[model samples]
Target: MGIVINQSIKNTIITYIGFAIGALNTLFMYVQFLGDTYYGLVGYILSAANIMMPLMAFGVHNTLVKFYNEFETEKQKSQFLTFILFLPFILIIPFSLIGYFGYHQIASLLSKKNFIVYDYVWQIPVIALCMGYFEIFYAWVKVHLQSVFGNFIKEVFLRILITISLLAVYYNFITPIQFVFALMGIYLTMTIIMKLYALRVKMPSFQLVIPKNVKAIIWYCIFIILSGSVANLLLEIDKFMLNFYIKIENIAYYSVAIFIATVIAVPSRAMHQITYPITAKLMSENKHDDLNNLYKKTSITLQIIGGLIFIGIILNIHELYKIMPADYSEGIFVVFVIGLSKYFDLILGNNNAIIFNSKYFSAVLILGLLLIGVTISLNIVFIPKFGIKGAAFATLISITLYSLSKLLFVVFKMKLYPFTIATLKSFALLIVTFVLFYFWDFGFNPVLNIVLKSILITAFYLGLSYYLKLSSDINYIINSVFKKIRN
Candidate 1:
C-alpha cells in the first residue's frame, strides 16, 4: 500500500500537470490558434490512430505484462522478451501492406462528411505504429517494476512537444499542415526515446529461441488484440463516428468537453501502472485475501479521490465552459455525462487489471465487442438528433453498462468485492458535496472562481473525509503530509 500510494501520488501529479498543458492546448491555444477545423482535424487523426494502435501492436504490450513472470530461467526470459517484441510484425507487416494498397478507399470512407480529414488520413497508421511500439516498450518497464519514467514520458513529454508545435502555429511559424506533419514526427521521436529508456531499464539479449510458454503467449497476445481493440474503440470511437454525422468542427467542441471530464480519470490511470502488475502477480499466486484487500482499498481510495474530482468538474463545469469559446458552450451536457461515466469506472478500481490478467479475459473481450456494437448503434441513432452531446450520451451509456458488467463478473467469479462501509460513506459524501457546492458561486472571474471554489471544496471534502476516517490509508497519508509540513 505504501508503494502504491507513493507512486500513485507521484504519477497523479505528473498526469495532472500534463493535463494542465493539454487544457491550454485544447481550450485556449487550439481553439484560438488553430480554430475549429484544424483542431477537429487533429482530434480526428489522433482518435483514429489510437483506435488502430492495439491492432498495430498486436497486443504485445498487454501480453508482456500478463506473461512476463511465467519465465523462470534467464535464457527463457530473454527468449520471452525477444518473442513478444517481434510478435507484432506478424500483423504490422500485413496491415501496412493493406493500408498502402487501399489508402484511397480508407481515406474516402473516413472523410465522407468532412473532406479535410482525407488529407491527413495517411498519418493515422504511421502514428499508430509508433504508439504501438511505445506501449510495447512501456509494458517492458512495467514488468520490471519501473514505471515512473515511462509515466512521465507518456503523460508529459508528448504534450509538451505538442504545446511547442501549437505555439509555433499560433505565431505563424508553421501552418497547420506542417503542424500535422510535425505531430507524426513527434510520435515517432517519442517512441524512439521510449525504446531507448526501456532498453536501459532491461536490455534484451536478442535470441532466436522459443520462449517457455510460447503457445500461451501467442494466445494471450491474440486475445489482447481483440480486447484492447474493443477497449480503445469504446474510448475513442465517439470522436471517430462524429466525423460521419456532424461537421468536423463539432468534434473540436466535443474534444474540449471530453478533455475537461477526462481529468477525473487521472487518478485511476496513475494507480493502474503499478496496481496492474501487482494485481497480475497476486492473481497468479492465488493470494485471494491480499487481492481482495487491494481491490477494496483501491476502490475506496480512488472513489474518495475520483469522487472529489468528479464533483469538482461537475460543479465547476459551467465556469469552465464560460472560459471556453462561445461555440463550445453546447458541451455542458457532454461534460456531465462523460464525467459521471469516468467516475463510475474510477470506483471499479483495478477490476480491469484483474479481468485482463486472469483466465477469464476472453469472456470480457466478448462482452466488450458486444458493447462496441451497442455504442455504434446508439451513436448512429442519437447523433442525428442530439449532435455532439449525443456522442457523449452514447459513451455514458456504454461505459456505465460495461463497467457494471465487469464489476459483477469479478465479484461472482473471484468472490472478491471492492466495496466497504467506506465506499458507501464516500458515495454519500460525494452526493452531499455536489448538492452543496454546485450552486455556490464565488462571484469572481471564472479563473478566480474556479480556484477559490476548488480550494473550498477540497479543504472541506478532505477535512470531513479525514475527520471521519473514511479510508485509513488515505487518512494516514494526509497525516503524514501534515507532519512533513510541520517538521
Candidate 2:
C-alpha cells in the first residue's frame, strides 16, 4: 500500500498536469488552432495507431512486466528480457511487409468513407511502431518499480511537446500534413527517451541466451497480444469507426466528449502503473489474502476519486460544452455515455492486472476477443443510425459489458470483489451530489459559473467523503495535506 499510494499520488499529479496541458490543447488550442477537420484527422490517426500498437509490440510490454520477476536468477531475468525484446520483430516484420505491399489497399478502403484519411493512412502504422517500443520500454521501468519517470514521459512529455507544436501550427510554422507527420516524430522521440531511461534503470545484459522458460513466456505473449489488442480496441476503435460512418470532423466532436469523460480514468491509470508488477509478484508468491485486500482497497479508493471526477464531468458537462464551439455541443450524450463507461472502468481497480497476470489469462483471450467482436458489430449496426453518438453508444455498451464479464470472472473464480459497503455509499454520495449541483446553475458567464460550481462541488463532495471516511487512505492523505498547511 505504501508503494502503491506513494507512486500513485505522483502519477496522478503528473497525469492531471498532462491533462491540463491536453485540455488546453483539446478544448482551446486544437479547436481554435487546428479546427474541426484536422482535429478529427489527428484523432483518427492516433486512434488508429493505438489500435495498431498492441499488435506491433506483440504484447512484449505486458509479458515483460508479468514475467520479469518470476525468474529467480538475475542472469535468467536478463535472458528473459532479451528474448521478449526481439520477439516483437517476429510479428513486426510480417506486418511491415504486408503493410508495404498493401498500404494503398488500406488507404483505398479507409478512403471509401472519407478520402481525407487516405493520404494520412500510412502514418498510422508508423506511429503504432513507435508506440509499441514506447510501451515496451515503459514496462521495463515499471517492473523495476520506477514508474514516476515513465508516467511523466507517458503523460506529460508528449502533451507539452504537442502544446508547442500546436503553437507552431497556429503560427503557420507547419502545415496540417506536416503536423500529422510531426506527431509520429513526437511518439518516436518519446520512445527513444524512454528507451534510454529504461536502460539506466536496468542495463540489459543482452544475452542471446533465451530463458529456459521460453515456451511459457512465448505462450503468455500470444494471449497477451490478443488480450492487449482487445483492450486497446475497446478504448480506441470508436474514433476509427467514426472515420467510416460520418464526416471526419465529427470525430473531433466525439474526441472532445471522450476527452472530458476520459479524465475519470486518471486515478485508475496512475494506480495500475505500480499495481501491475505488484499484482504479478503477489500472484507468483500465492498471496491471495493480500491480493484480495489490495483489490478491495483499490476499488473503494478509486470509486471515491472516480465518483468525484464523474460528478464533476457529468454535472458540469453542459457548462463545459458551452465554452466549446457550437457544433461540439451536440456531444453531451457522447460525454455521458462514455464518461460513465470510463467511471465503471475506474471502479474496476486492478481487475485487469489480476486477470492478465493470472493463469486464466488465456481464457481471458476468448472473453476479450468476444467483446471486440461485439464492439465492432455494435459499431457497424449503430453508427449509421446514430452518427457519432452511435459510436459513443457502441463503446459505452461494449466497455460496460466487458467490465461486467471481467468482474464476474474474477469474483467467481478468484473470489475477489472490489465492491464493499463503502463502495455503495460512495456511489450514493456521487448521485446525490450530482443531482443537487447539476440543476443549480450559477447563472453567470460560463467561465465564472464553471469556476463557482467546480469549487462548490469539490468542497461539498470532499467534505461528505471526509465525513463518511469512505476511504481511510484518502482521508489520511487529506489530513496530511491539512497538517502541512497548518505547519
Query: What are the RMSDs of all candidates, in order?
Result: 1.0, 1.0
Where does model 2 exceed 4 Å of error?
none
TM-score, every prediction: 0.99, 0.98
- Please, what is the whole-model Cα lDDT of each candidate in the order they appear? 0.90, 0.90
lDDT of 2 by residue, 1-487 (tens): 9999999999999999999999999999999988899999999999999998888998899999888887888888888888878999998899888989999988999989888888888889889999999999999899999999999998999999999899999899997777888888999999999999999999978887877777988888888778878999999998988888789999999898889889999999998999999999999999999999999989999999988988888877878888888999989999889988998988988999999989888776788899999999999999999998888899999999999999999999989878889988998899899789867987799888888888899999999999999898899899999999999
Query: Across residues 1-487, which tens digit of lDDT does each residue of candidate 1 receive?
Result: 8778888888888998899988888889999988899889999999999999988898989888888887777777778888888888998889888889999998899899999988788899899999999999999999888888888988899899999999899899999889989999999998999999999998878797877567888898889888888889989999999999999999999999889999999999999999999999999899999999999988988999988999988888888888877899999999999998999999999999999998888888888999999999999999999999889999999999899989999999879899988888898899889898877998889999999999999999988999989987789889899999999
lDDT, model 2: 0.90
Clashing pairs in 1: none
